[model samples]
Target: MTRYVMVADLRRCVGCQTCTAACKHANATPPGVQWRRVLDMEIGEYPDVRRAFVPVGCMHCADPPCMEVCPSTATRQRDDGIVTIDYDLCIGCAYCAVACPYQARYKVETPRFAYGEAPTESEAQRHEAGRIGVSTKCTFCVDRIDSGVEQGLTPGEDPEATPACVNSCIAKALHFGDLDDPDSNVSQLLAENQHFRMHEELGTGPGFYYLWDRA
Candidate 1:
């Protein structure tokens, strides 16, 4: 079984928010929702303060809490390890949202556009009709990944098949690949770096990793 994962190289991130922009553009999310974001953390004392950017979103946990708490069975984890929400099945009870510690799940009862209440031509093109009153979050660009695989293209290595956030990362801080493959870039990167996954104590077995102070 192939497990997909993502890695963020903390040393390389510049907090440019390119990944955020790319994700919004790709998913066409409304104004208040951000599928991906870079959090700025300040370290050290005030005078010696230094900043670090931590990119966060859905972790795609091996033991997804959202899936466990979904009353409608709307949340599912694919064989490839991508966690997705079935909009049609979701009742927007927000149980999954409450269960998710990452705060990745979102529900919107009303439609919203970037500029105004009325959706623009471009906004309407990508707007998901069934998304209203349903849970939504990142899909790890599964459509792109699946399509790329069908076309015999390597996802992590090929820009076309990779996640928009990864492709838009100017600092090359983001990496996506099959963690089950030892030879994959993500696997090799993890093996050679000092990395840590968020909230490991929760026993969620998150697939997202943060690499810093490389070995």
Candidate 2:
């Protein structure tokens, strides 16, 4: 029972948004669609104000409301705890989008380019026709994980198997690994840090963890 999870260290995040750019480049998402994004927050009063950059996306929860509400059954969770969307089976009703508490889901009705009318060569080449009008979100780069595993690589330890966002973090604030493994990187981080998951009271059991302070 491998449960994949990501941890974001708030103390280290510098709000650079390199992870956001890497996600867009890797997924080739439309102009307005962002699968990975960092939220900037001003904490405390004006005199004691401090900025925090929180990276957010699909939590790939232990109990996903999006999965329960998908009429077309396009949203599916893998045995390894990776949530995936079958574009071929997706009907694009936006049901799953509404059910997602993390606001990670995106449904684009038409092709959109970075430019006004014309798509650059890279955008055109990477554009996914099947993704149009479908509920799409982060899969923690499952393709890379699966492919790397097939090639005898450890996901979190190997750069080739890790998620693009974690690899691209300029501040090294993001981490990904199997939560079920006590020896994993994420597990160790959680054990040594004071952390919280967003909206945990909703009972979504989100896999994304935010480390705020040392334990």
Candidate 3:
């Protein structure tokens, strides 16, 4: 009953977007398809206005609408709360993308590179052929988690097991851990802070949490 989750501290985030760059490099996502992004939000009136850099991506909900709407059954959720897409089974119908409320899904119809028509050596080496012409989203670096577990390491505590975005946060704003474990980092964060989830009213049961204030 290990439920994985991420917690982002709004107070600590500086909108540097290091997490975004780390995600791009780790996942080798094509241009215009950002699996992880920070939304620069402005709150309050003119004199009291302030900016909030909210890091967001796939929520990996307990009840994912994308999974329910997938006609091909390409989208699936693991027991640990990670949502993944099977490119081979996907038909590129974009049904899951349409059903997603967070707009975290992307459908790249053709192969594109950062440098025009040609891909750089690094891009070519890391390019995933299966990702083309299919819906793609963040997996929270499940491979790292799985491998780390096999090696007797604790995810979220171990850099090799943690999500790249969480590990790359310069401000230490992002956190990942098991929500089901009360002693886990994410669980402690939620218990000690005033936090909220995006679109929680929809009842998707998103695993991503935002800490707005100390409790």
Candidate 4:
């Protein structure tokens, strides 16, 4: 079976949050909820310390902790190791959210909607609820991937054509591809660079890797 993975170069990430913005726009998340968030942290002594921005989203782990603890089996791993929530099946219990080692799951209030026109309270409420009554988050733009497949380009080859984050990345720090393909950039990046997964001790076996190091 073929599997795909996502990898990122932390060194190249500028923390501009183009990924975050693109995700919000694509997913149409209301103001309070964020499917993709760039977490910033500052550590060490002021003179010698550094600041880092780590973009947080579904890690799509092989041994997903969220899956193990889900009571309703709302969360499941995809064939390619992508983790997703079944909106119709989700009971809004937030058990999966509590179980995720990466804290990736979100249990937010169903937000109101807003169309391109100016927002009234009722219109805003309806428009905001794009997909109501479910655990919500990034699907790694699976819809986009499917769409790209309809076109000529392979999933990872079409940056703008596949994922919103990839399209928004001015630095091209984030990469998406089939990990099984040795020729793919995602695979080559992993082989060539020293990458680290966040919260590795938890044993979630995240598919995503970050390249943050001293060169």
Best by the lDDT measure? 3
lDDT of 4 by residue, 144-168 (tens): 8767767767767776446788778
TM-score of each predicted structure versus truth: 0.97, 0.98, 0.98, 0.88
- Candidate 1 residues 130-176, lDDT tens each? 98999999899989999999999887999888999999999999999
The sequence of per-residue lDDT tens digits that candidate 3 reaches over residues 181-203 is 99998898999999999999999
Question: Whose lDDT is higher: candidate 2's or candidate 3's?
Answer: 3
- Residue-level lDDT of model 2, residues 61-111, one tens digit each, is 999999999988889999988899999999999999899899999999989
Q: Tell me which residue pairs clash in candidate 1.
A: none
Top-down lDDT ranking: 3, 2, 1, 4
Q: Report per-prediction Cα RMSD to one decimal.
A: 1.0, 0.8, 0.8, 3.1
**What is the model-wide C-alpha lDDT for candidate 2?**
0.93
Q: TM-score of the candidate numbered 3?
A: 0.98
**How many clashes show up per model?**
0, 0, 0, 6
Tell me how far the alpha carbon of residue 59 in candidate 1 is from the true structure, in angstroms, after superposition.
0.4
Q: Where does candidate 2 stray beyond 4 Å?
A: none
Candidate 4: stretches off by over 4 Å:
112-130
